[model samples]
Target: MTISAAFSNALSGLTASGRASGVISDNIANALTPGYAKRSLELTSNATAGQGVRVLGVVRRTDPVLTDNRRSAEAMSLNADNLARFHADFGALIGPSDNPGSLTNRVAELEASLITAASNPSAPSRLDATVNAASDLAQSIRSAGTGLRDLRTRADRTIGQQIDNLNGTLQDIEALNARIRRVQLSGADTASLLDQRQQLVDQVNTIIPVKIAARDHSGIALYSEGGAILLDGSAATLSFTTAASAEPHMTQANGLLSGLEINGMAIRTEGGASPIRGGTLAANFQIRDELAVEAQQNLDALARDLIDRFADPAVDPTLAAADPGLFTDAGAAFLPADEVGLSNRLELNAAVDPSQGGNSWRLRDGLNAAGPGAQGDAALLKAMSAALTDPRALASGNLGTGVMTAGGAATAMLSITSQASAETEQRASFAAATFTEFQRIEQEIGVDTDAELQSLMQIEQAYAANARVLEVVGTLMDTLLRI
Candidate 1:
């Protein structure tokens, strides 16, 4: 080759090597960075002019299929994680059936107290103990109901926060899309912009399951899996209304609960038909509207069963036909329509509850009797004990339509709690396993520092070779001119 031509080739080679080294350094530096894609310098051989190399641009190494799979896996993992946490929290509130302070254990204590009171109907201390046990049982149900409502309220608040975050992310993605298009049109490096966009997309995926579509001018459009447009040329708006507090009677069917809205359209927040399933937001809604609500209903049913058991006319004939029984709905007969909040409103009958200034001797007499009956009359106490152990149908649909004793009803409620706890543990284990697998796959596709270092070594050799060629060319030119 001519000296001039040799000089031109050496210069091109040196420039290409320098660019490659820079790209390699970037890869090594971002090896541990989340969402960072490894980059490589694209080069082409210039055969026409015999130039050593021509830099095309930087290419970001990524597997579109793997990335899509990871996004989907992450969404599912988050959904499971939220659900598991809800179940665990609920279980902690109710405690295990065998625990001394559990609902069933409290019921058992009351039943045992009633038997002891029946054996010594004239003993004021025994009667007082029975009343205390009954009060304790009522308070346990009320506390559990309150705890469940609080969980629902918190879930509602979290849903609102997630909606706000989702809206913000969508807006950011829309702005990034415009910038990316402008950079592409100007023929400038869009790698940084693309990275930012990917990070935003990942955030969006954690909130809700979405489908991404390529748009013109290097832009992307986001849509819900159910076909709601989240973003196109502009970001779509999302909104939610949060309730100050949740109550057992407040439900979606009654329009007392909040639901999600997207771009002025209402959307289902739960079930298979829900538009935002397979994400953390969906899990929160399901906990609030479905799981927590169901638990509250079960507790209310247990309370209703307890009230009804003592309220039976046969158990307390001394009470007027319309008088409140041993256990009443806030000092009155429980109306079937009021079963929704029975747990929260359950209270011991004032006639037997000393805290309500009633006589303890009333346990042996009729609740409505003007004064204490025979001191040794054990008829009412025996009947009350039998009433507690009597087999009867429970009001809870969750426990199925089966006849069971008071203790059996408590056992059924505990069974429900145990089942939920077990399911939560299983789901958590599965989610952890899924997340670990996805992380492994992601790591496989991430930057390899060792590979980048080896590439840098190769680039250094090429740069040194090119520099030597230039040095030799310079010496030849000097020699020629000197001659």
Candidate 2:
């Protein structure tokens, strides 16, 4: 080649090397960023007409499929977390406690008091002891209900705060979208803007899984799997509102103006429907609605059942009044009016009070051995014991008849709660394990300082070679001039 051509070729090589150095610098700088896939500069020779090289663009090596899969796994993990927490709280009520004041211990104390009352059926102090035992049981149920309600309140507050943060972050994302679009239109370097955008996207993914796509004017669009448009360039935005204390659900929607819609339904700032599906939002919502509410409801049901069952007096075979029921009044429903079937289906118990006056020996089938036999108070106590033993008597929402026979209703409630608690703990353990694995994998794919340092070494050698070429060319030119 001619001297001029040779010099031109070397100059192109220098430019290519400079671009490569820039890529290496970028890689080294972001070596610690999580989920940051490695980036490489694409180079192509411009050998058609003249000799030169072109920087095609910066490309990131990432597995989109893996990214999507990880997001899904994260959603499941969060759900499991909520379930686990629910079970833990419920477990506290049912599971044995180290404290002497635990609910199970209190129930056992109540049972002991009952046995004492049976032994001294005519003593006022023994009857009072039974009453005291029932009172203690009520107190235990109340305490459990209180804890559950408190948890619900805390969860609601957290959800509110998180939603506020989500809104703020979304607005920021919208602003960044504007900036990215502007840079793209101007043909300026938008890599940094893109990096910022990805950061926001990643943050949002932890809160809720989303689908991202390119939008008009070099902008991006974020969508829910359910077709909810969360963000789109500068054209759209999503919003949500927490409910008033009385309302059962919160509202949510999408779009900047003309109101927003969640799942195609319009929502307002007033109480709206829930907007959660597989993310932190879903997890928090489950804690607030399912776990917390159910625990409160169950405890409340037990309280009311106790009160109603003990309100009446039991009569003898001769229809003479004998043993009185344990409670005088039942508590109100814990659920809201909108909760369908919550009132009738969620009642405590009707057969609890044995006092229709005896001969009242109207033996209820499960209680009376001879079927309406005249054993009177004796039969009633036996029935109570039988009722307690049947596990199916405990009312769980609308599920089954409450396990309220006298045999072991309290223990049954405790057992169910214990199982739920164990389930929650197990789920939490699994989520923690998966999260650790995710971190490990992320580290593998993300920045590694040693590896980046090695890359820098290669870049340094290339830069030196380019500089040497320039130096050699300069020396050769000087020699020619001297001739």
Candidate 3:
């Protein structure tokens, strides 16, 4: 071969080695970055084309099938985790009165006072203690209601932040798509641009799964799982907005980024879906709606049950027709607004006042056939205690059948909370196992140290051989000139 030809071939070999080295450097740099796919230089022999060689592009190492499966499993695991947290928080609110100023303990204290009062029908000191117990129970209910409302408010704020993040990520993805298309059209090296774009796509996946499509110029287009196009070409972009109805919406239009839009879709809904998933957005939405709101409703229901049952003469004969309930419904019908539930109509009746009605007024369970006026006060108290312990009585619509005495709401809350705690722990364990398995499978298909090292050795030897050829060519050229 001519000296020039030999020199050129050697130069090409050096270039190929450099490219391989760059790929190896990149793989090592991002070894720890989550969702980072490895890449390799795609080289083609130039001997066939009557040229030195050509670098096709930097191709990312990935398995689309494995990625999709991992994402799906993550969604289910996250759902379980969120449900468990909801129950845990609710459980905290539902347990015994001894929990550092918990309402359940306060209610129990009041019940003890009432029992004491019953023992000495005419003792003024006993009556006063009974009144104090009732007042304390009312305070406990108010605090619990406030705590639940606070949780709801925090959830709302988190939802707003997640929506903002989703918008930002979509904009970035659209912009990257435009850059990639432009590079491809200009016949420039678009390998790095593609890498950046893929990284963006991976980020979007964490927020929600996306469907990617091929573009005409070897470019890519992204779409939501729902078939709404997120990107088209250089002329089209998807935009998202919070509509007047405050619902999340997405739309596609003109310009690199003007078309695609997403409006008010929370991380998840009742039927289990949202435009976004996988990452923190899904977690936040679950807390806001399902966990926080549902717990609030459960507490509200319990409160209403307490108030309506205690205010009736059948449950507390000392409570006259005009008197308000013992614990007072401090909550509005759908009220998280005021952060408290109370009955405006609850008050002990003065006519058959426990202090003055010959100390004859009694507390009765709903099952007693005798009217409040006829049942002995002692029989009513026993029935109320029995009702508080029975879940069936609580589930039944008959508040009179089981007057949830002081501490009853606390007991019910504890039960709900315990169930939730178990669920949360179980879900977390499952998620951990799933994540570990996914990583194990991915490592098998991912970068292999032994393979890359062996390839590196071969590339280096080829580079050295090519350098020797260049050196010989230079020596020959000098000798011929001397001759």
Candidate 4:
């Protein structure tokens, strides 16, 4: 090779080695940084007459298939976790059978108090105890029902927040795509831009799982798993109006609540037909519309049974046909049409509730006993106790026909809630395990300091070799000049 060519080749080699060292340094530095991809400097042999190496830009190394899998698993894990949390929260509201303050336990307490009161009908303390137990049972069911409404409200607000975040993320991705395209057009490295875009896409995936499609100039398009276009040339607008508080009678179907809209079109956000059904957004909708509604229904059913069982004229006949029994719906008879919010309005009969200026001896007599005439008559109290344990087929709430008494209905409700909670938790565990495995694999293939150090060592050797070549070339040129 000519002296000039050898010198040129050596300088180019040194430049390529320096760039490679910089890339290795970057890899080692960002090893633990979230969303930072390992980078490698692209090189080409410029061996025409020994010119040396060409630096083509830096490339970000990532496994697209593995990243896609991990993202899907992450969405699934979050969905399962949200559902499990909803069911568990509802179960806690109703109280477990083992929990002393649970709905089932309250029912049993009221039943026992009635029997104890029946044994000593004239004792004021025993009568007071029965009334107090009745009050507690009603309050427990009411609190649970109210809690379900609150869960729905909170979930609705969360859905709004998630939708906002999703929209913002898509817009950011769109802007990043533009920046990346410009960089690519300018023949510059877009590795950092690509990394930023990936992080934004990850955020979007968690909110509403989406699939990425390759676009020209290192840009990308996003679409939902169910084929809804999220970002093409522009981002789609997602909208949801949150309610101040969810009510028993309020529902999207009834036009009292809002459903999700994409680009101003109503979209199904529940059941198997939902376009966005595998992320945190969907989970919040399920909590707001499905789980909480079903739980409220079941609680209302229990309350209905308790109210109807005692409302029977045969159970407390000292009054007229319209007189409510020990339990009432907001101090009145429970109409069949009003069962939707019965649990929320469930209350002790004001006539027997001492807190409401009622007499305790009324328990030994009747709800409308005309000022408690019978001081020693345990018949009514025993009858009320029987009314509590009487077998009756429940008409609603999907508690099945397996439950007989009011206590049995409450037990069935709690059991169903607890079982649902457990099943959802199990699914969450499986999803989390899958997500963990995928994440671990992705991390394992991520930046390795040891490997980067080895690469640095190789780059150092190349730099040294290139410097030696330059030294020899310079020495030969000097000798030639001297000759």
Candidate 5:
């Protein structure tokens, strides 16, 4: 071969080797960078009759199927995590049934106090203890009701934040799509832009669980699994109005709470059938609209049962049909139609509350007794004690007829809540496990510093070998000139 051709071939080899080394260095540098794919250099023999070699530019390597799987798993994990957090907060509010301060325990205390008062009905201290216990019970229910409403409020605010993030991400993706198309048309490598775009899409996936559709000019369109189009030609806008606070009577059904809107279109914001399902966004809405609302209903029903039991004239002879019970709703009679916020409004009857200008002796007598008939009468106190053990089918709560007394109703409510929390936590664990497996598989395909370092060694050898060939070519040309 001519010295010129030899020199040319050696130069091409050196150029390709240099490019390969650069790729290896880049891979090693970004070994742990999230969303960064490993870059590979392509070298090919020249097509010309006596040409050497050519560099075919760098290619980014990623397992598309594996990436999609990882994204889906991550979305499920996030959804489960949000739901689990809500349950944890709610469970903490009521506490375990075995806890001393739990709702069930509070009811048990009230029942015990009633029995103690009955043992010596005329004793002011015993009657006072019973009154205090009942008051404590009402306050406990009110605290729980307030806590649930607060959770709902926080959930509503979180929804707004997530939707805001979603909108911003979609807009950024749209901008990136345009940039990627421009770079592609100019025959430039769009790999880096593609990585950024993928990261943004991953963010959206965690909120709405989307799948990508390849568009023209290296652009992409995103669609949720629920058949909602998040981005086609442009980013879709997500809108939500956060409330100042949440209340039992405030609900999405009654238009008091806001639902999500997508690009001026009202979409279902809850459940598996929602347009944005299986993600953190859906979980927050479920907490605000479904879970918290249901909890309030059950609590109100429990409070209503307590009030109705003491409202029975047979139990309290002085109480008329129109009067409030020993346990009053907002210190007034509880109307069936106004039971929505009964738990929050439940209070001890002011007529028997000494702090409210009444006497504890009212417990031994009747709430409406014009005057104290008998100071030593234990009959009313015994009847009041028996009221707690009376078995009656509940009126409002979905708790089946099996629960007989007030304490049983409280136990049943706590049991239902705890069971739901356990189930959700289990789901969260499984989803997290699945996500971790997919992440491990994806990481296996990501940049491997060990492999990259090995490749660097090979590139060094090729570069040295190419340099030696060029040296030999120069020495041969000098010898030929000397001849």
Candidate 6:
């Protein structure tokens, strides 16, 4: 080749080697960066005559199929994790079956107190103890109800926060899309912009399950798994009105609770059956609307059973047909429609409450008797004890349609809690295993430091050889000019 042509080839070789080395260095530097794909320099022969090489563009190493799979797995893992956390919290609130503070233990204590009072109906101390136990039982139900509502409120607040974060992320993605398009049009390197976009996509995936679609000018559009468009040319809006507090009666059916909105349209917030499924937000919705509500209903049912036990006309003949029982609903008779908040409203009958100007001897008499009857009359105390042990059908769908004693009802509630906790834990384990496998696959496709070093060595050699050629060419030109 002529001297000038040789110079041109060597110069091109040096440029290509420099670019390759730079790309290799970038790959090594970002080896541990999350969502960073390794970069490689793409080179091609120049079609023009006598041109040695050309750098076409920068290529990012990635497995789109694996990336999509990982995103899906990550969403599932987060969903299951949220569910497991809420169920575990519920289990803690109810406590273990053997725990002294548990519902069963409280009821058992009340039953034992009744038996003692019945055996010695004239003893004021035993009567006082029996009344105290009954009061404690009512307080326990109220505490459980309050806890369930508080959990629901917490879930509602978290859902609102998640929606806000999701909206912000969508806007960021939209901005990146515009930036990517502009860079592509300017024929500049868009690799960095692509990496930033990938990171944002990963962030959004944890909030809601989405399907990505490539658009024109290197842009992307996102759609929910339920086919709702989350983003297109612009970011879609998400809205949620958070409640300051939650109550058992503040249900969606009564319009006292808030639901999700997507671009001014209502969407389901139920559970797996909801429009947006398989993410942390959906899981929170399920906890707030389904799990917590069911727990409250079961508690209210137990409260209803307790009230019914003391309100039976045969047990207390002085009580009118509509009179409040030994255990009353806010000191009044329980109406079926008021069952929603019965646990929270349950109270000991004022006639038997010492703090309410009532006497302990009244337990042996009647709730509305003219005065304390014969103190040795143990019939009323014995009947109350027997009522607690008698089997009756519960008023809660959570326990299924079945007959059970007060103690049995407590057992059923605990069984429901244990089963739910176990199922959630199992799902979380499976999702964790699946996510780990996907992450491993992604790591395999990530930067290989050894391979990058090897490539760097090759680039160094090429650079050195090109520098030698250029030097030789300059030397030959100097010699020719002297001659």
Q: Is candidate 1 or candidate 3 better by lDDT?
A: 1
lDDT of each: 0.85, 0.56, 0.56, 0.89, 0.88, 0.88
Q: Please give the range of 10 consecutive residues that has the lowest summed lDDT in model 3.
A: 245-254
lDDT of 6 by residue, 216-289 (tens): 99899998887788999999999988999988899776888888899999998775567689888889988888
- How far in Å is the alpha carbon of 31 misplaced in model 5? 1.9
Model 3: lDDT of residue 221: 71
From the highest TM-score down, the ranking of the candidates is 4, 5, 1, 6, 2, 3
Model 3, which residues run further than 4 Å from truth? 1-4, 48-52, 96-107, 116-136, 218-221, 226-268, 272-293, 314-318, 330-410, 448-454
- Model 5: per-residue lDDT, tens digit, 342-435? 9999999998888889889988889999887687787777777788778888898776667578888988888888888899999999999999
Q: How good is model 1 by TM-score?
A: 0.95
CA displacement after TM-score superposition, residue 36 of candidate 4 (Å): 1.9
For residues 1-483, write the lDDT of model 4, one tens digit per residue. Answer: 888988988999999999999999988988988789999998898866446888877889999999999999999999999999999999889998889889989989999999998887888999999999999999998999888888888898999889889989999999999998998898888898888898999998987889999999888999989778899989999988888888988999998889988899989999776899899998998888888888888888889888888888788887667777788899888888888989999999888877898988888877787676767789888888998998889978889876588888888888898899999999999999999999999999999898889989998998999999999999998999999
Model 4's alpha-carbon lDDT is 0.89
The prediction achieving the highest TM-score against the true structure is: 4
TM-score of each: 0.95, 0.73, 0.72, 0.97, 0.96, 0.93
TM-score of 6: 0.93
Give the clash total for candidate 3: 45
Model 1: residues with Cα > 4 Å off, grouped in runs? none
lDDT of 2 by residue, 351-393 (tens): 3222222221222222222454332234444434333333445
lDDT score for candidate 2 against the true structure: 0.56
- Cα-lDDT of candidate 6: 0.88
